[model samples]
Target chain A: MAPSDVNQGSQDDDVLQEAANWLKAGKKVALATVVSSWGSSPRPPGSQLAVSEDSTFVGSVSGGCIEGAVVTEALEVMESGESKVLEYGVTDELAWEVGLACGGKVKVFVEAVQE
Target chain B: MKTSMLDQILRDQEAKTPVALATELATGDQALIYYDSATGSLANNPEIVAAARQAIQDDKNGTVKLDAGEIYFQTFNPPLRMLIVGAVHIAQPLSRMASVVGYDVTVVDPRQSFASPERFPGISLNHEWPDDGLRELDIDRRTAVVTLTHDPKLDDPALGVALRSDAFYIGSLGSRGTHAGRTERLKGEGFTEAEISRIKGPVGLNIGAISPAEIAVSILGEVTDCLHAKEKKAAA
Candidate 1:
């Protein structure tokens, strides 16, 4: 990882700034931030993902396993304009489905990119 | 309001100022808090400001709950700093390695010739006295000070200021006997034995390093260990 990647916030901030620009351009957008995490997750709590009305996306929440689901929910959030928190846990059965080999829990807070 | 808040935050980050963003998750309300100024439009809530400021001082990021709501206090601090008080052979690799690992490194020495831009390109070079240079830099918890110049005139003054400040790690390069002499000198300079003990003489972990580059690696390892240890303690 680059030195900038170590802090995660700085990297996420750049993504958020880009999202804000996209929002200003009249593109509907939603932001998903990992508010909390448990066990040996690859990404830290402040990791982020931004999704747009056109299905454009930036950043990552689960590295891979749950991004597709989060982006799906983010598109819905952009349409509904209601913010929600999402929880994903890697259980034996769920892991098999999501392709997550490790056991951990991550809670992501999703909200519309307001203003 | 949202545009300006984000703008101010980006500005602060560009200036390397310490700041925090407090968001009430329930309501989606947000505020940008500046640590040094303690000034923000964050709902005029003293509890939130206090909590956010504490997190800023600690330089750690997390969320906290209050009667008002669950506020996520995300802190933004300046990059970690490494002040090497000698522009010597060890510092060449040390500064490069430190910078690679995300530290804003500054090499200080009174010898302008040694502290030239040619010797250490792409790094901040300070040709002022060690003590004055450190004072100008304003050593903080995020900074680590290491004095590689064995000359008392150079290293002692740097050590003096570092011991008094909150700089997380302080190390001096010397042999065991030299460190003993330095201990006595520091005692004469009015530092207590406990304070003097803070100086990690024979600096770096005991990896039996001999070459200057190898020594730099050892020192970097020790500095990294110290930083992580402090983070662990704060988390606990």
Candidate 2:
């Protein structure tokens, strides 16, 4: 007999639903999903983050480490209407710039929501 | 991803159906993969479809290397469930612990007094007879059933229904002697030895659990083990 709120789908479902709602309201949306992870990555594969053109976002693909960079890339995806895969590891120079220094690696796929 | 595909994923989730979203990284094309059917851009690729099916079975998300390019499979499965038949002392802690681990739990008992909301607080409760309650729940492969009531009248009927369903775990809380008698009665009811053997009597893993809370821990541990074992076998 968990509470009603506890039964409300899952966190990932909520993120997708939010993206859909944003799209229906005429806001360009992009979705980023963690395709794979290794080492001590905080989030697992299938973790999602939804971003709108207004910089509004929902969910997370990492433990507050690479979200800002992902949002920046998501806006670009929304503009280009093309999907892209991004990889980050502690050993990468870009990872150091993005602060994903948790001794883990993650690959994320970012795609724009087609109308 | 197409808006229509996203809508379909939400709809399938609402219907509690398992699905895998397969995305080809190179081209950004996507497909929705069901157990026996496929749709969307990548549907025509048999290798991607096969890999999607494997991902769904393993209940894990991973990328598959294909001849054309790598495809990432994101599996969406309905929540797991645990149904406790007795609503007894053990059921109280077991339900809460199972909920913490993401099991949608429901406590069933014919006696309304034992299944009271005050006792269970925020949990789901069913006051119907055990057999009737289980039938209404429509136990599926992702469900676990545990009968905690020591009464033969209640536990036996529940066990009969659980054995016939696709529940991944079926356990009965009882002493060895009590379980022996229960098995004899089940045999008398025409249940085959193999079928009756499915019940993990004495329920949990043998951690020498003494208290109700400790016993709850043991049961949840066994349930988790069974679930992972199934996944490991599927991955193999």
Candidate 3:
């Protein structure tokens, strides 16, 4: 995922903004931002997900778009307090495939938020 | 190694202060805020919030240290809001759309006849005239206002207020000719051409919309474009 190009007031952004508030309050959080989009993706660029210290969920990186994948990524980020980006829509013949119905690809940039 | 900021953030969330929660979701930290339009305050701000405002010169984010808290406002920026005027038809869908994007949207209008909770359902409906009503509401540096009502008596006065106030995006509904007339009126009212230029008359994007619902969607697109104008990608 590169970076958000279009700014949307989608649920994902709202949830992410909420989490940003938590971060300002000195909370340890992780952000999953949909950095890319393809075809008819539900969550577009700037869509975000905020994960709390105890694995609480706020916002979403995908609108049921690629959630299962994002949750797993959140778990990893939560464990190590590390921030990183992961790209979706990568097609592999051998990899387990979940067809994002939008036929559009979404790249979620997940970061471990820290002061 | 402590969750100092986390606790404060949770409380802010509970207390309904538009707390911005940031976490590392991927490569870098990603940020989001829960804005409480009612209180107009960020929940429990870490000491850093103050320092950010002071040293950073950009209240968006900065760093400082204080007791019982850790520094975490060291990310992205502050909150931005969406304000929709004229609780008429298009305001409904746009309100829904803006909500998805996390805007603490406020709909303003003087006609209580149209600006009722029953009409809008889940919006922050403010039954005040644009010129008169805006003063009480917080049309600050981070706000964007859209005037959907075509009637200038309702729309023009509000535009006057929004133009003077700090609303980032000031839009109004009108046809090309109507927009020109509105501009003439505004100019007649002693508004500068620069200020008049701030408005997106004939509001909504160029979607060639015909229906009210479609028009609402298109208008919302324009509003989002206005809100994200700075955040948009370079013409790729």
Candidate 4:
């Protein structure tokens, strides 16, 4: 079996459904997906994190190492209505500051869900 | 990502339909790619459409470089499935183990007493004959077929159907002698040796397993090995 992760198949479905429900409830939502990963990454490509306007989040892009930064970018995406990609690697200064200490790298895409 | 598009993707997922979402990085334009159709703003881009189709076939998420920038293809495939033909002792632990590994499991046994809701709670149970039940379930490439009955009456019919299907893994629980007998039977029934070779007889890894649960572990391990064998080859 593939390495176990909290954000597996069914959980991913739940995240997307929750994002849709939050949208129906009048909350702005942004979705962050791990577009690519390299080395001992906590999550594989396609792992996702859904964030609402108020910063309520579901799912994960990493073990919890880079979610804060992703959520921060996600809020900006919700505001701007434009998608953006963010890259983080253990070698980056920002990555060290954010504590992605697992010696892995990931590229995340953040986009707003428009009606 | 429009709410309607997201909803449609979720609907496809619920229906176990394989789909891919292609997003153009520069413009944030998106397209939904199905096996034979494409939709959304970037639907007309032949390059992106082809790449999306390839991604779906590969069952992998990836990026395609374009002159403009890049297109990200995220594939959503249906969960893997396991069809256990016989609610025997090994089936009990095997079903639970397979479920934990993310397979949508179905237990098939014609005997109601063996395939009871009590025996396989929360499992999809089919009391039809093995061949009929397997036909109804519609085995696909993502399915694994395991015949644990050991009884030729039950296991043989299931093996017949499974051999003709596209199931990625096919196994029968038995000894070498039993498997040899099975090979002869299948040959008499007109099955080619190559086709008969696909069944992993004396099934599971040779881990020296003796107990039912231990045997289940070895089978699951072998199943996992077969499931990822292609990717491992590619990586190599």
Model 3 residue A1 CA deviation in Å: 12
Highest TM-score scorer = 4
lDDT string for model 1 (B1-236, tens) is 25556667767867988888777777667777765455445648888888888877766565577877887766777788999999998999999988877788999998988887888999999888999999999998878999998989999999999999998899999999999999999999999999998888899999999999899989998888887784346445
Question: On lDDT, who's better, 1 or 4?
Answer: 4
What is the alpha-carbon lDDT for the whole of candidate 4?
A: 0.88
Backbone clashes in candidate 1 total 0
Q: What does DockQ come to for candidate 3?
A: 0.20
TM-score of each: 0.77, 0.73, 0.63, 0.84
Worst 10 residues of 2 chain B by lDDT: B227-236
Ranking by TM-score: 4, 1, 2, 3
Q: Candidate 2 lDDT, tens digit per residue, B35-99?
A: 98999989999998988998777677877779869888888888789999998999989999888
Itemize residue pairs with steric clashes in candidate 1.
none
What would you estimate as the lDDT of candidate 3?
0.63
Question: How far in Å is the alpha carbon of A43 misplaced in model 3?
Answer: 8.0
Q: Give all candidates' CA lDDT scores.
A: 0.80, 0.87, 0.63, 0.88
The sequence of per-residue lDDT tens digits that candidate 3 reaches over residues B111-147 is 8878888887787877766776777775886678888
DockQ class, candidate 1: incorrect
**Candidate maximizing DockQ:** 4
> What's the true lDDT of residue B87 in model 1?
93
Candidate 2's C-alpha runs over 4 A off are A1-11, A24-26, A54-56, A91-95, A99-102, B88-101, B113-128, B135-140, B160-166, B171-222, B229-236
